[model samples]
Target: MVPEPEFRSYYGQPIIKGPLWHEPHMPAYLYLGGLSGASSLLAAGCELTGRDRLAAPAKIAAAAAGTAGAAFLVAELGRPERFLNMLRVFKTTSPMSVGSWILAAQSGLAAVAAGSALTGLLPSIGKAAGLATGITGPMMATYTAVLVADTAVPSWHTGHRELPFLFAGSALASAGAVAMVAAPHREAGPARRMAMVGAAMETVAGEVLERRLGLLAEPYREGSAGRLMRAARVLTVTGGALAAVSGLTRWRTPSVLSAAALTAGSLCVRFGVLRAGRASAADPKYTVVPQRERIDARERNRAHGR
Candidate 1:
């Protein structure tokens, strides 16, 4: 005879509530933040290489995106005024606090870089600001993964090791897309390489995460999250390949298309990840049973040893 399965509740509830905000706002913010960070890096690289024209636009875009995304993030918080509470205390264990500081620094540096670029009167100072922005930009792009992973959400928290790489890849692709749209071929080549690197990293990280997650992976492999993940994978891979080839060829149209595809793919990834987190949080099975079993197993092992 077999024993009956035990059912558990999540916080004494069968189903979890969804996040208050809609998908577009949060996911769009994620995309914009990444785009802004990567743009800063590109700007710094361009300035170093004497590509002032490319650097100028990249700086402006980075500032705009960082500012806008930060605003959106503040708005998303239930108590907008309490957003400052995040900065009041710094906890290394809390990704939210860390991310807030990173974004704050990224935004400030990007603003300085953009201002200098526009005025042209502070070249040396602007160069310094751009350099600082570049250094923090990658962290801004990738830290969101840490933020999501630090949560109790099964899908995201379980994939903590890979989320940073995934986000970094998406950020790089986004920057590449903007460069392809704005810069000349000579200046855009490096952006293309960055995009390719980002795309490859995102793909590999996502794949490893999916494989390692086991039951938790269902959120990413099924339903709306699954659909979005599939789309992201295809677009990122195909667009990256095209961008890589375009470096050797003078085909401007294909390059532009590839950039667009990569940008779209990155957006898809953000939304998919957000949805997967929500899904993981919503299901009692994801939250309760596994944890309970782990605790029980640990207790049993201790008792057996005694």
Candidate 2:
């Protein structure tokens, strides 16, 4: 039997550099974008169901969150003006460019909807705008997963299939949390249900991601990333249970507590993912070893020519 090929990097260093994104910027952007995307969809649903009270606040929150996320993304680029430069090009292959366009559309429509709601003007136009976000909203929620997974990071790349589902679930949870907290008890039923379903999706997706990654998932099990992930699991489970019960009991305290926990858990998930990617990228073994094994397998296949 042929032995596994050995590999080494320059001076025993990582083969590829990790992302340069810093704290409170990239992660915050991710959280806010996800919140905005899902909230916009929820607002549209509430509007369709004639829950004006819920729709108004949800629309406003979606606009605010999307705008805030955009600002954070610009800050990460080192200058607010640099964001404008991205508009100069439209590249279908670039996730960043596609995301920028989607964000702009989602934020613009949400802001218009919220602004019209405030002035009690252009009711039909506002509804149209809210409906428009429904198209871009899901894309906004899930595209970030592709953006990150497209990178060279071991953890991120290997889990590409599951990341979109994970992010989508997290987005739903965040949106539901905001809606539950901000909307009145009478109108918060859908929000609670959404939170419960989202929590389940996130938990299941996370488990699948870890299991499929095998050794690549080590980053999520050790160090600060591990701590955050563990805390996220606890918080997600607790929040989901509370949300499930909150619907039946209709208790304000349980609803609020559940919302808070779910929101915090979503943030932890984003941060944990970022940290795990960094950890995976920083370790030379993750990059070198997997690639060497892949090369060996390819060579074996070619030699046999079966």
TM-score, one value per model: 0.89, 0.95
Which pairs of residues collide in model 2? none
- On residues 76-117, what C-alpha lDDT tens digit does candidate 2 reach at each position? 999977888887788999998888888889989999999998
The best candidate by TM-score is: 2
Per model, state how many residue pairs clash: 0, 0
lDDT of 1: 0.85
lDDT (C-alpha, whole model) for all candidates: 0.85, 0.91
Q: Per-candidate RMSD vs. true structure?
A: 2.8, 2.0
- Per-residue lDDT of model 1, residues 160-266, tens digit only: 99888889889988888788767777767777888888889889988998998888889998899999999999999998998988888887887888888898899
